[model samples]
Target: MSRKATITQKEIVNAAFKITKKEGFEQITSRKLAAAAGCSTQPIFRIYENMDGLKKDVYDKAAAYYEDYYNDFNKTHEVPFVDLGLAYIGFAQKYPHLFRLLFISGQGTGGRSMYDLVNGSTENVVKEINKATASGAGNAQQLFMQMWIFIHGAGCMAVTGDYDLDEASSVAMLESAYKAFCLG
Candidate 1:
């Protein structure tokens, strides 16, 4: 009688994500992942051509989850900018390690796609600013850049415990900064 294996591709990916989250991405290895998944490296190699492929799959999965979080907030709120800022903080607080990997640690190829997601969200804010200001002299691109910098800086600080504020206070400060950016 032939016995079927219990390990699967999804299980492998899930194990990889858990390992990376707990032990940082730099430490991830196919053998480590295989062991974590309770399988041999052959399964991983059969599912993914190489380490890069596995990493890409992991990054894409994380990105999808991250995007879903942001998209859920977007669907519930009318103001995309404020919601995006809150989402930023929420993501950082909820998944501190993943947040660091996505934005802080300079790892993987997903950074460009992550930037595009933020840029797309910021463009909506720029549109709002344009509508509010009614001034052709102001540059939306520049405004978006400034706002992104501020939001990212705040998010990094909050995630890294550089700031002393509690969750409520940190979110409030971020909202205030966003509103101030809109006004200026």
Candidate 2:
């Protein structure tokens, strides 16, 4: 009779997530995951068809975690979009490895265009933009795209450790960009 598996898929994923949290997605190898999971690599191969499948699971976990982080920030702020932008940068500052894994390195995005990315992900934020500025959907989308470019840049900067922008400065910069986009 075949022996029962010792390590579960969830447990392996949790170990992979921990490795990703500390070392970024690129560092997730079978050997490293085995070390993290405190088991032989055989269980990982048994659970996942290949490393790509495991990476996808890890990416999904990171994405969900980021969404929760954004949602938590939105709950406390007056302007959700502005606060979301701040939260995006703050997330990068706080979790640079995850930020690089999710955004900078293009682990999950694949070949999707920026247009598709914003349309698919920011429907609620666009609605909030319309409510806040009374702009039409087209204008709101435009503003969001513009702001997203700036916010993405700030996030990248935060992860790179090149810029040391404090919260106050970040808010001022976000406000300036928001007003500029709103006015134009």
Candidate 3:
């Protein structure tokens, strides 16, 4: 009779996710994952065809974690449009490992174009921008894209430790970008 396995695929994925969250995706070797999961490397190989497969699952988990974190920030903040950008930079500041994994490594976007990436996921953000700035759909979208460029740049800088940004400064920059984008 075959022996029952003590660990599930979900458990292994969870362990990988934790490792990736704390130490970045590059750290997730089979041996490391097995150690984190308290199992042998054989189970990891049995569950996943290779490390890419495991990393894909870990990427999905990291993406979901980011969505929840970003959405929760938007829900509570008074200025969802500008504040959302701050929250993004804030995520990079707080979770440099996860931020690098999700954004810097370019794994999250897959092959999607920037247009689809922003427009597809950020309809509500556009709506909020429209309401706040009284701009029409096209202008709101343009403004969102413009501000997102700044926000994403700031996030990258934060993740790379290139810039040490404080909330007050980030908020000021976001507000300025919002106004500038609203003009053009």
Per-model TM-score versus the true fold: 0.72, 0.85, 0.85
By lDDT, the best candidate is 2
lDDT of 3 by residue, 105-164 (tens): 766546643333333355556556766665343466566667778878988888888868
Clashing pairs in 2: none
Query: lDDT value for candidate 1?
Result: 0.68
Better model by lDDT, 2 or 3?
Answer: 2
Q: Which 10 residues in a row give candidate 2 its minimum summed lDDT?
A: 111-120
Sort by lDDT, top down from the best: 2, 3, 1
Clashing pairs in 1: none
> Backbone collision count in every prediction?
0, 0, 0
Query: What root-mean-square deviation over C-alphas does model 1 reach?
Result: 4.1
Give a tens-digit lDDT track for model 2, residues 110-155.
5544333333365546555765665333477677778888888998
- The ten-residue window of minimal lDDT in model 3 covers 112-121
Cα-based lDDT for every prediction: 0.68, 0.76, 0.74
| C-alpha-based local distance difference test score of model 2 | 0.76
